[model samples]
Target: MNDIVPLFGFTTTPLELVSFVLSVITVALNIRQTHWAWLFSILASGLYALVFAQSRLYGDAGLQLVFIAVSVWGWYQWLRGGTAHGELQISRLSGAGWAKSALMWLAGFGILSIFLKSYTDTDVPYMDGFLTAGSLLGQLLLSRKKLENWHVWILVDILYVSLYMYKHLMLTAILYALFVIMAAMGLRAWNNSAAVPAAVAGS
Candidate 1:
């Protein structure tokens, strides 16, 4: 694990470095609305599971496994699940969609937080559950091509950076900070794309 992997003047394990790079690549690809992002996400999540396990963050470790499954689903949806030509088109969530997503987030947080507190040795159950719930909804939105996914990620990633720092995972923390920036770029890109259609229809 102690192979030479440079991370901003600090050295880290190969697993951490690889996961960090994969996460960066995945989010960068996502910002471009590329289906290939899921492929990178699968690898990143697997490596991160191991990393979190080593850190004794069992909830986070489990979440990474869930991320692997979500990545596969996201890949299929992005490539073939759509109303036209089997390729998904980007779109915004309606008011009803927002309401449902909010409900899902709240329910997931409550359930996961309780489970973590009761079943795991995790020190920050609520915060971990918060990130997990937000990420689940964000992944669902991304798979469905909802433009709001980036917004969800922006909120989640900001908190995640601090969370990882608390756990002393500096390399991964930096990676999440980059995720924050990429998510912002993604939101802007999706907004511009969504606006183009509206402007054309208006004209």
Candidate 2:
């Protein structure tokens, strides 16, 4: 871990720098609705797993592994999970879907937080669990090309920024802040894409 030294004259590790660059590229591609984002996600998540592990954020480290798997699944889903011909399309979650998502997030948060608090020496189990649960939901939604995935990310990223800051992960906190902005841009881009068909038909 200490093999790679200072970055940009900051005390940042190589793992953190690599993860940050990959994450930024991943989100940028995601905002453009490109399938290549998953590749970056896989790499970024792996590095982040190490970063979180070193920070003693066990939950988040495990979450990064899950993110890697989810990234692979998302890659296939985006390529072949759409209506007719394997083309993914932007869609909104229904009320029922929202309720289900909420239930899942809450349940995950509760269960994971308890486990973390009981089994780990981590000081921020609740916050870690919260972000992990939300990230899982956001990943699922993104895989399905749901428009509201960006909304999930927006909320999750804000909380993550705060948590990372509290943990003295300034670079990670900044990354999460960038995530918020990218998520908003993604929301707008998907919203416009979703409306294109309607506008054309109405015209």
Candidate 3:
């Protein structure tokens, strides 16, 4: 799986190619608010753990393991995390929620960067930790069907493209670039979904 092969005039490992395909499908399902996205996320994250490990991106490798666990919980959340244990619905974060999320991101970045720098040989510890933290927040918000999840994803995905490029993971970089676009579309779709309830209530 680690063997490099030519693909689309570029080079990538079979692991990465498979991960890229699964990840794209996962995001497409997510944009459509389908719970099946979490199932694909588990598959993608498992493969990506190996891909990032090979690149010595310990933060990302560790993050993929976390993603797998989170995907499972997220799957459950989407099924029964709403009012009265109903299916989760698209919603916006409150002002206090936004503030809390920001604090959590910063705190996670601090702890992760310190751990990665002290315990790993990764060359981009700070960058990796920052994105890893943001990704966790984004994933949490997404699990709950929060509108702000897309905002977090857009920023994190943009930065991930550059980080993957610097690490010479061209295929993964391209995947993150695509994530940015997909996240934006998700934002619009979720926003519209959230509004429908309000429109119906006012009718």
Using lDDT as the measure, which candidate wins?
3
lDDT tens digits, residue span 1-203, model 1? 74757667866798898888898999888888888999999999999999998876777788889988988988988888876657777898899999999999999999999999999888899998888899888988998889999989999999999998888888888888988999999999888877776448447
**TM-scores for all candidates?**
0.91, 0.93, 0.96
Q: Please give the TM-score that candidate 2 achieves against the real structure.
A: 0.93
lDDT minimum window of 10 residues, candidate 2:
1-10
What lDDT tens digits, residue by residue, belong to model 3 across residues 11-102? 99999999999999999999988899999999999999999999999998999999999999999999999778878888889999999999
Task: Give per-residue CA lDDT, model 2, range 1-203, as digits (tens).
Answer: 54556545446677797899999999999998899999999999999999998888988999999999999999999999876756787899999999999999999999999999999989999999988999999999999999999999999999999888887777888899999999999999999988888448347
Instruction: State the RMSD for candidate 2.
Output: 2.5
Q: Which stretches of candidate 2 lie above 4 Å from their native place?
A: 1-10, 198-203
Candidate order (lDDT): 3, 2, 1
| Candidate with the larger TM-score of 2 and 3 | 3
RMSD of each: 2.8, 2.5, 2.0
Give the Å shift of residue 161 in candidate 2: 0.9
